[model samples]
Target chain A: MGAEYDQHVAVTDLGNGGFAAELDEGWVVGGGVNGGYLLGVVGTALRAASPAKPDPLAVSAYYVSAAVPGPATVSTRVVREGRGSATLAAELRQGEQVRVTALATYGDLAGLPDDVRTTATRPPIPPLEECVPGSAAPEEVRKVARMMARFDMRFDPACVGWTVGAPSRRGELQAWFRLNDEREPDPVALLTVLDVLPPVTMDLGLMGWAPTLELTAHVRGAPAPGWLQVRHVTRNVAGGMFEEDCEVWDSAGRLVAQSRQLAMLPR
Target chain B: MGAEYDQHVAVTDLGNGGFAAELDEGWVVGGGVNGGYLLGVVGTALRAASPAKPDPLAVSAYYVSAAVPGPATVSTRVVREGRGSATLAAELRQGEQVRVTALATYGDLAGLPDDVRTTATRPPIPPLEECVPGSAAPEEVRKVARMMARFDMRFDPACVGWTVGAPSRRGELQAWFRLNDEREPDPVALLTVLDVLPPVTMDLGLMGWAPTLELTAHVRGAPAPGWLQVRHVTRNVAGGMFEEDCEVWDSAGRLVAQSRQLAMLPR
Candidate 1:
């Protein structure tokens, strides 16, 4: 048996717009909880607060501090209940200090107009069997970041050259991902998947804890079941920070989600 | 003297984390205040709340409702004051209704390490005099959407073909922008310029209001004094919504600000 995502992320209502959840230790990325996992916790609370619109369309989170594994409380506020969607705010607090704060809009993605027009091209990926496993991380690094074991990940061989001392310095990473439990990808799950890959900075031969400062994700459509293909690219690494843009496509080749985040580089 | 942006977006301290600002009618894009202008209002308040770190590094806002021309209140809360940056939250409320909510990080951009490395390319733009004026809007459009007159804008001609009834249908728009008041572009002003261009939907011959739902921006560096070149591109227009990604380059040819917004297409 392994740590299942749904169970680890589940929240219990604490009454009066409050929720209680546990930050599982197995999800720690670098001395703290993974940002995507914290986002999932906030997303769960927002979904409960806005039941009329349960699917998250867009979520933007600001990581205030490193979250540790322990009991955390989520306070939610329904900002608006519009005709098309609902806007909500949530803060995950370990105690009096807020760990993560987020603003999100939730609605039934199924209800969105079935219109798909795009100039986006589906990136080609080698068959899953031919790609390098995400677990290809050096054993020493994985010893600390237990989060890597929770997902089934495959990386494009060309992008992970840094692992073997052959860095491309391209600042890009392409991977296929899904939960080890075989849970299907939903809008909420996409939140975790969008951030599953290691920081693209690794591809630049710079590898360390690149903590995300702020992350904003847009769920364009519902994903089809199967491995998710994700592409992450970073354009500029300046001001002691860099911005990473992510695009996720599902088994059906539809653009399921897009996200951009600003993160700091290690000193 | 011509409705200077500084005066229009100026916020008065109301004491106790509250600020009062007037929404100018001339800044309305359709039936409401431009999203970026509203972001500036919130940005100004956040700057005041976190004086230790005055520059805006990252900002994300979710539009809750349409903001009409009138008085608005911005309530700000400083979430964290870390050693490197401060995180803040602001709400733009008109009376009891929250028109917009935002989360931002403030820090001295000048204080950031002067490490510059980017794989991004600068998009080419025509000379100021050779391009079409933004005021080239139809006499009717210029009347209601008075926001156009606030700046001296030049289009890449090739992208604004929709104005002449022939659009490239490429889902992109490129232009040069600067305030008519000759105000130099700063971090705050970049908030406005980033959203100044008419919706890129116009590039697809689909001219109408594309109200922004959520906008996230990252200020990479300080700008050099001169006309700013901007490139707007939209790849996925799905589910009654489209996402526009914008890059703002200063005259010194440095990438100053980058923003991505999800907006709804007129039904």
Candidate 2:
């Protein structure tokens, strides 16, 4: 049997460049399907549309409405075909409603040379034994954010002080992320893990559903089979919205992915 | 008469949810139209599509083909309309060729509450008189990148050492950006200005045409009428590509916009 994540994100080809995916309720957060999980569904469709270009280089999505556990369709349109990459657009729909619109470019990551590589120093986090589990959130908070069960997320003790009613007010979260099933993370998995953390606003004393308006992720490299070090920092929060920037480093000590998202501050 | 920026970005309404725009050669870079200038043209059509919501809150675009000086058409579709914002998709085409595809959210920036505002400190830049004008580039370099003539860009002396055969190898650029005609930058203008600087790869000794594949910008607020302090930094450069993160702080020192773009290194 395939891994749980791969099974849940699987899509049925509709024979005409469309895909049908069933949303799994196990990934719901705050009464709706998690934004990252939805992104993975669309990313899967993009890969299916362009089989030759298997890796997604960059993907950007604008969430129009919250997705629920139900049947949805993804329509893919190939925009351009180049030697190095191909661009495609996809829309997730339910009946007559469009839940998300996205554009992506797919290419072969393994073929690119890593000769000119450099990364800003990865955020310092304590060893795995020193971090707190996502389950550390109060029982009441866990009930509202059930998506936390999908991943084995361990947050830096200093960054999750809000759980005990002592927010650091720093707008940051550093965590180690891995699938509970021990499934290796691929480019598609990076999209979902990039958004798995609780809203950084929780660190600033505002906690609840922070609806994502838009998100963009760049897959810089493939990951090794192990835990992914993830860090989220929100340096700017204004105009009833906050922007969170995230970076994921692999067990091999390489930056695997980067993402930025704009979301509403929980009211 | 309208300002140069407004005139260059103005689009003719097709009255059928489409717009007609003429690509200006003045904004060409590396033998093709600049990506940000193309984004400005599409942002204009998005505003015209949803006249009720005139500000572009978040915009993401993928370049399908490099455009040249010519006529192009923008087709827009309203994906969703909310009380606070509306989402729209646009495609820029020349004849039967699609040059760019984009998605955007429009809203009223003036209506947002600045109550929960915070930002990373602006990069340290020397006084206006102490910085070097973009004209400081060698004549050979200027000939290849004619877009330099459209802006009054003053670069931080510490970051532009590449021009003098002494690259700092930092992969960063800090500059003061303003239209030469002294036009005030609106939300649309912010889209264009975000990509005005030379690619940060130059600082790493990888200069020339670094084609942008995807770019995403979040418009945080309206700007004050003055120079915009801009900073571009590339943290991870690998897989034959690099990702640059940018921030635009208005003259009032309020963070107005942020952008992240994935681009290929010059071959």
Candidate 3:
């Protein structure tokens, strides 16, 4: 098993509320580091700074500039501190340039009372065993797809044809996702894996890279052990921008994490 | 026309990256002030601070505590500033207690090239003229609904059956939205209006107030000056957690602003 996911996300003690993170070349997508991977590093730093609350309830990251693959430093400022929750401001800087800036809230997920219950439905899709493997990339976007190989993703049969030059009237992708590496799924790993999928535009016959402007992820509950299910879809593409809404469910069909991002449409 | 929207969102000049804001009692959603209304005031501060870039691209607001209706002061720290964009961190304090914290990015919307052509579709629903208005609250929730009366919302006929005790198999709400108080639509108004719709859980027969834990909004482009349509839906409501995905379209049928929030279900 590869150590890329764990090594790339692990942060070192720089002391004084500051830490250093490395942007592995393997995680690069289209010349820049993956936005989710960047946040995973920052979230790791935030978690280390405050051991009291380990789970990141929410992380809102804005990409300021391209983070070239290499060493990056992250520093955090505590906005507010309470009994079981803390709001923090963090930035990952490559030397003098701030590559990514994020505002995050961390809380005790284990202690959160999830008492209210209702029949939550997953979107209509086939069973995991019946879906097709989906790591193949288009000839032009193989550079991105290769980096995405770090995550083991198998797509629903109906959604996998878009990569083979089949045109779709809608923007949708459903898959069972887990890291190719042996590391188990956690909140930080979930953060990195959430954005590793191909752009939904590919299904609708659009090309080129779509960089994220702002991404916000909310950890609903601690992910259960096993392959997590993810559904990524976009309903609107307007004014040179499109939204990616991701719903991640645990192995038991419980929703554990959800994210939404605004990304620039490929030019 | 009532000046409540403008007066409530207007920030007084305090200089030195600081501003004074007050929450009018009429904007209270329950026992606490509305989270979106608080951010709108903070958005006003950010816009005033950077007149060159008047459009708000993103805002991630975290509710630290219950903000009482009255005077509040806001202080901002500049995270990063560039030629065309700026990301700032701001916090709201009622007195000695910090009530709200947000990280916002503002930019010039006019100069951004919207050359990417896309065919984005809104959810299946009736047109604005065919839907009925939706301000009716359960007898016990009138106190909260009174605060929501500031917005003129017409719900999709299919989703409104929940209010009358009809069971809905899924959670969805599509409505034509605009400020009932007659304030023209802008970025801040768009932010406030995006979250003003009734929670989708109501359609699932869930009761009580669903308070937002965190909200992130992305303004696509400056909205055309007219009624902005919105679609609010939740794909899952598990373990007392749910996500509200909102897409706001302008009068010209262009997607303008989008938002996602994680809220706690009332016990």
Highest DockQ, which number? 1
Q: lDDT by residue for model 1 over A224-255, one digit each (tens)?
A: 99989999999989889999999999999999
Tens-digit lDDT track of model 2 for A103-202:
9999988888867377588778899989998877777777778788888889899888887779999889899999869989999999998888889998
Any idea what lDDT model 1 has?
0.89
Better of 2 and 3 by TM-score: 2
Give lDDT tens digits, candidate 1, residues B173-264: 99888887688988988887778888998888777889889999898998999899998999999999999999999999889999999999
How many residue pairs clash (N, CA or C atoms closer than 3 angstroms) in each of the candidate models, in the order given? 0, 0, 0
Q: What lDDT does each candidate get?
A: 0.89, 0.90, 0.79
DockQ of each: 0.89, 0.82, 0.49
Interface RMSD of 1: 0.7
Candidate 3 residue pairs in clash (backbone atoms < 3 Å): none
Fnat of candidate 1, please?
A: 0.88
* Candidate 3, superposed: residue stretches over 4 Å from native: A114-120, A123-146, A155-157, A160-162, B82-84, B114-120, B123-145, B154-169
The digit string of per-residue lDDT tens for model 2 on B1-267 reads: 777778788899997789999988888788788898999999999999999999999999999988988899999999999999999999999999999999999999989986746857777789888999999888877877878888899999998888877888988899999996899888999999889888899889887888899999999999999999998899888878899888999998888999999998888
TM-score of chain B alone in model 3: 0.93
Better of 1 and 3 by TM-score: 1
